[model samples]
Target: MAGPTPDELRSVVDRFPTPPDAEAFGRADELLDGTYSAIAESWYPELRRLATAYAEGDVLRESVLEHVEAVPSFRISEGATPLTRRREALATAAETLDSVAEVSAWYDDLRTLLADSPDSRSLLERLLHDFGYAAAHVLFLGASSPEQVVRRLRWAYRTVGVRIDSVSSEAGTERTTFTCPYRDVAAGRCGKRWVCHEKLDRVDDGYVTYLRERGIDYQRPRGCAESERCHSSVARDGPSQWWPKTPPSAVEREP
Candidate 1:
């Protein structure tokens, strides 16, 4: 059996994250400036909470701080460059893509410490749903057609380095055929034991909340672990329950 060549690997690595279709999905440019940071800012705190719950205020909680601090922070500011121009718009998109990569790597860090914990996947899934939920508010804000929803979702996962191949409708519901987010992470964990099929798209919580806002409910018919390709479908709403729980703001604002 031949392994992937350097060029082959580079091609796959380079392919991620083609920008969302602007006409179908709305305000992707809107995401570059504020939405990416807002999502991470929300995500980081909730992740900390989940970790604390897992650590239960023990020494492991202190290790959580060190582990978190190891991942560099991400923030995108409004530079002198105006997004109206093609180049600047592309730059912003590129930066947003980078931000997604940073978030994914941060989750990858958690896999080591939290993988063995029974409650970890559920906590992580809730946080992922919240990430997609926040993203939908901005990325798909003005777009709601079925095609647009699919495009928005593809873009959402692409930002996190997951490639979705196609979206199809069945029984009045839409399903996406895509690679699992854990495909890359699997080699690091499951060798012959193959404990992942049971895991079934822990990262797809984003898909559920993201698509649900668009008025769709879903079913994932195929969850096979032998191959990286997975047929996935979804489920949910945003955080009135506060989507994985956030701390109250220190200051109240004017209406």
Candidate 2:
């Protein structure tokens, strides 16, 4: 596949899907931003207490606090752009962190601290929903070419921890099918893998629909959260031939 040109990349980036509650989520983040410092002040000490209890020392505890404290406000940064425009926010947040390991540790401690708070749990769930949208952003977007689009789709799924166990193509057709393991959520080690089947289906629908809308035929025949496993195929002409086999009807044709 060819590398995506700047314009082509922009075209794909333009169509990224926004979470259903994006506006509400953005407002919540904005409100939280105003109180984040106070929240951190109130909570960091408690986190430190937990750290001590868990045998984590001041050095490591302080490191976590510093990282969280320095995080940029999590509001939807691109107000001029559609709410659908979302990848930059996640990518920016990712850049703010030192490493993937740091991200994992930060969340692990936060979850531990908030384990007993129902209100906090609800807020965390919203954050996670948005997180999934960001992780799967590229799957709903366009690409420089059909081949590049497929490449982007595969890469996006992998980023969300969806392993592509196998891939094969049918002869004379640009159709390619990828089989995935049965795990429903692909949140990697981020600890937010509790996403529901509904959300997973939405992601799969968006991916397949985006391909179809852009003239690349495709279908998602199975969803890991709802079926035996996740499976999706793309073709050049259309998805009709890719549908599951069905027995011929007993009734005669109108020939």
TM-score of each: 0.34, 0.31
Cα lDDT of model 1 by residue, 1-78, tens digit: 111233432333333333344432234335333444444456455444535443342222222323343333222222
Candidate 1 ranges beyond 4 A from true positions = 1-125, 166-172, 184-186, 190-203, 219-222, 234-255
Candidate 2 to truth, TM: 0.31
Q: State the TM-score for model 1.
A: 0.34
Local distance difference test values of all predictions, in order: 0.42, 0.38
Q: Residues 1-255, candidate 2, lDDT per residue (tens digit)?
A: 111233432333233222224344344334334323333445444544434432422122222333333333333323233222233333332333223223334444443432222243344444544454454455445463556666776776687566666666565233333444333345453112133332343445445544555666555433332234455555564322100010011011212
Best by the lDDT measure: 1
Positional deviation of residue 151's Cα in model 1 after best superposition, in angstroms? 1.6
Task: Name the lDDT value of residue 29 in candidate 2.
Answer: 31
